[model samples]
Target: MTDITSTELKQRQSAGNAPTIIDVRETWENEEGRIEGSQNIPLGTLPDKLDELEALKDQEIVVHCKGGGRSASAKAFLVQHGFKNVRNLLGGFQGYQQA
Candidate 1:
C-alpha cells in the first residue's frame, strides 16, 4: 500500500489539491477531532458505504485511523474494490496531530 505523510497532506490541502481523506476511526473517536474535511466512514461500515465512494474511484483517497493499522486495512479493501488511487496515512491521525 502507498503511504503518505501528514505534512504532505497538509500541503495538498493548503494548495486546494487535497484528495478525499477518509477517517476510518469510530464516531466517538471522531468527536475528539479529525482532519477538517475528512469523511467519517468507520472501518467497520466501509463495505456498505462503497457506493458512497464510487465517484472517487479515479481520484486520490487518503485513509487514516488512530494509527496506521486500520488505514492499511482500508487501503487494501479499497484497492480490492477497484479503487485506482488510494494511500494510507503513515502513522494516521496521531501522526497528523504530531506534525
Candidate 2:
C-alpha cells in the first residue's frame, strides 16, 4: 500500500485536493478529535462496511488510526478488496498532530 505523511496530507487539504481520509480508530478514540471531513469506520467494522466505500474504489483513500497499525491493516484489506488507490497514513493521527 502507498503511504502519505501528515505534512503532505495537510498541503493537499489546504489545496482542496485531499484524498478521502478514513479513520479506522474505535468510537471512543474518535471522540477525542479527528481530521476534519474524515469518515470514521472502526477497523473491526470495515469488512461489513465495504459497501459504504464502493463508490470510492477508484479514488484516493488515506487511512489512519490512533497509531499506524490499524491503518496498515485496513489499507491492506482495502487493496485486497480491489481498492485501486489506497494509502496508509504513516504514524497515523499521532503523526498528524505532530505535524
Among the numbered candidates, top lDDT falls to 2
Extract clashing residue pairs from model 1.
none
Lowest-sum lDDT 10-residue window in model 2: 1-10
Candidates' RMSD to native: 0.9, 0.7
Q: How many backbone clashes does candidate 1 have?
A: 0
Task: Please list the residue runs of candidate 1 whose C-alpha ends up more than 4 Å from where it truly belongs after superposition.
Answer: none
Q: Which ten residues in a row have the lowest lDDT in candidate 1?
A: 1-10
- Candidate 1 lDDT, 1-99, residue by residue in tens: 468999999999999999899999999998899999998999999999999899999999999999999889999999999999999999899999998
Task: Give the top-scoring candidate (TM-score).
Answer: 2
Off by over 4 Å in 2: none
Candidate 1 yields a Cα-based lDDT of: 0.94
